[model samples]
Target: MAKMVDQNPLKFSKYIKTYYGISFVEFLNRLKIHYFLTHVDHVDQFTLETYIYQSGFANRSTFYVAFKKYVGVNPSFYLKELKGK
Candidate 1:
């Protein structure tokens, strides 16, 4: 990212931390989670596995941890909530 932006990597990470109040990895994870939630519709257990990788998560456990951290609910329950709305 710093290479792409012509920035020093350390400086760039510092900027992200200051600006976003999160580390660069956290920012990227949040972006990935946001992408998955907004792009997926009609989510199911089988398809959730697919979308986990599609959202750039390496596996279900990591995705579940990140989802629970940021979204405040598991994906399945979140989908159910969305469906209720």
Candidate 2:
């Protein structure tokens, strides 16, 4: 991304922090979470584990941690709530 925009990597990271109020990794995780939420249901299987990998999460632990951190609930609980509605 820095190379694409002609920015230094450190400079780009700082810019992301200053502008978005989060580090680049957090920003990326948020993007992946959003993608998962929006696109997971579109998958034919509809399995959370499958979606977890598809969402660019490295593994279940990482996915659970980031999902809870950003979404304020674990994916299973969140999805259960969505189903209840």
Candidate 3:
């Protein structure tokens, strides 16, 4: 796909880092978190741990770190805020 797009993997990664101000892995995690949040109601189990795993995070700590970086709060806080709305 990178070759099809006329970019090497290294060059495409550098472009994303430059444009988005974060590493490619961080950007992908943010996207994963966003997707999980927006599409979470489809899941049967609604635990935060479940959500973290579904969001493509390997562990709670990493999920929380990425979620906080992208959303400016912890997932619990985000859920609370969502509930209030």
Choose the strongest candidate by TM-score. Answer: 2
Worst 10 residues of 1 by lDDT: 39-48
lDDT assessment of candidate 1: 0.88
Clashes of 1: 0
Give the winner by lDDT: 2 or 3: 2
Instruction: Give the TM-scores of the predictions, in the order they appear.
Output: 0.86, 0.87, 0.77
For model 3, residues 1-85, the per-residue Cα lDDT tens digits are: 3687899999999998999999889889989888877865644457778777877889999988888988898877877777666
In the range 3-37, model 1's lDDT, one tens digit per residue, is 99999999999999999999998988899999998
**Which scores higher on TM-score, 1 or 3?**
1
TM-score of 3: 0.77
Query: What would the TM-score be for candidate 2 when compared with the true structure?
Result: 0.87
* lDDT, residue 38, candidate 2: 94
Count clashing residue pairs per candidate: 0, 0, 0
Candidate 2 weakest ten by summed lDDT: 40-49
Q: Please write out the lDDT profile of model 2 over residues 1-85, one tens digit for every residue.
A: 8999999999999999999999999998999899898985565477778888889988999889889999999887887788777
